[model samples]
Target chain A: MKISARNQLPGTVRATTMGAVMAEVTVDVDAGAIVAAITRGSAESLELKVGDKVTVLIKATEVMIAK
Target chain B: MKISARNQLPGTVRATTMGAVMAEVTVDVDAGAIVAAITRGSAESLELKVGDKVTVLIKATEVMIAK
Candidate 1:
């Protein structure tokens, strides 16, 4: 199977919530997920579209897998 | 547009981390993301595959949006 060595993965933005300093996106994946934190301004500056496809990149250190 | 009022979203489980009580899912989405905490045991029982598709249900109150 082809796998991306980089942490970057592409997904569509399903939803977004904005706070004073942190913004979160509800990314839609065909079969997987990753919870990530980003610059609060990104949520606004990027104008995260509901169906817009974007990339989700994360460092392993930031990711804490349960299983 | 179709939206889930229940706050349920689909994503692939990239990774899971087990803690004493809580498990965190690093869900993969195209553009957006949501961080969720679940039962630690669920991580093991669910057997979240790297490419497994799963649903993320979030209660808005639990979400703190940073903009």
Candidate 2:
């Protein structure tokens, strides 16, 4: 699908921790891991599991750079 | 600083490709490079350059997972 945001990181789902309202998903990239906190509904819809390959999409507006 | 959203990727700025209204910043993490397309104003304000250590923040609302 076409997305507006430019940053797309391909990684493997390392683990998933689900809560009542949110789910924390850890994706293992080449160098490190990226943790995504998404809503439980979204997580369920994605049906994410360990060893699954997913792309982490980040819009520029949501990104903050600190030097 | 404390951010409410969860996803944070640590990386070094490798290069910056700028346009009239937007600038694409490439960050080199351990695994690969993440390219962020941000407004020129925000890029200028951050004073981002090559070799800068920055954190790429992705709010849960802005992140999408695809299998």
Candidate 3:
């Protein structure tokens, strides 16, 4: 499996309550760009640290680069 | 709790083998933009039909929008 993102965004990650099967990774995008967040086991296992810089890649056909 | 994509991407979703915990949603982004794709059970359970328009939202700290 491959994971890639555009650039690096700064955030502080906090461990949240466990999900149905795995724990949740809550990252507070300091700029409030991403006010709230929740990710499953994979991201958590990646050891998302607090005050870490990670990339979030969103891939969809509908993402339009409009000028 | 929420699933959102930038816009609607065109793709033909074919059910692949079941994942470790849930089934995988394999959508062939016909345009070849996404080229290869794999999503977890949630996308499949959403009733992603073949040749449907779905939005894929990827939230991470590293998305950089360069102007």
Candidate 4:
């Protein structure tokens, strides 16, 4: 689905850390490594694995700029 | 406050659009323009103005990776 979030980075899954309710996935992008915390359900649904190609998406509201 | 969101990008406030309840902020980072949707309260609190320097913050949970 099309999203409004402006930041989309194509990267490779560097690592995955699963928790009871949440999961952390680290992606290696050209800029740097981006870490994402997604629900365990979403993580499992995606069947994310290390070295998988993916694109990281972030919503505008979820972004904060500190001056 | 310290945050767990790993992506921190230093940029300049390119523009800001405020509404009754929400505001959209555009920051020009090294990579590109990063847009942020924040509460009007937060936008007012920050007093964000054009050309202001800021660091964009994103939480890991707010990030999503699509295969």
The TM-score-based order of candidates, best leading, equals 4, 2, 1, 3
Which runs of model 4 end up more than 4 angstroms from their true locations?
A: none
Q: Which 10 consecutive positions of candidate 2 chain B have the poorest summed lDDT?
A: B57-66
In model 2, pairs of residues that clash are: A31-B31
Q: Per-residue lDDT of B1-67 in model 2, one digit per residue for the tens? A: 7887566778899999888998888888776777777788888999999999998766666666777
If you assessed candidate 1 against the hidden native complex, which CAPRI class would it receive?
incorrect
Candidate 4 lDDT over residue span A1-67, tens digit each: 8876688878899999999999999998766678899998898999999999999898787898787
lDDT by residue for model 1 (A1-67), tens: 4333234446677776677887667765444443445557666677765777776544332333322
Off by over 4 Å in 3: A1-6, A15-26, A31-67, B1-9, B16-24, B28-35, B38-67
Model 2 agreement with the true structure over A1-67: per-residue lDDT tens digits: 5887667779899999999998888888776777877888988998999999999877665666655
- Which structure among the candidates has the greatest TM-score? 4
Task: List TM-scores of chain B, every candidate.
Answer: 0.65, 0.87, 0.39, 0.88
lDDT of 1 by residue, B1-67 (tens): 4433334556678776688987767776544554556667766687765677876554332332222
> If ranked by lDDT, best first, what sequence of candidates would result?
4, 2, 1, 3
lDDT winner between candidates 1 and 2 = 2
lDDT of 3 at A30: 52
Q: Considering only the true interface residues, what is the Cα RMSD of candidate 4 after superposition? A: 1.7
Q: DockQ (Cα-based) per candidate?
A: 0.07, 0.54, 0.05, 0.68
Model 2, residue B24: distance off in Å is 3.3
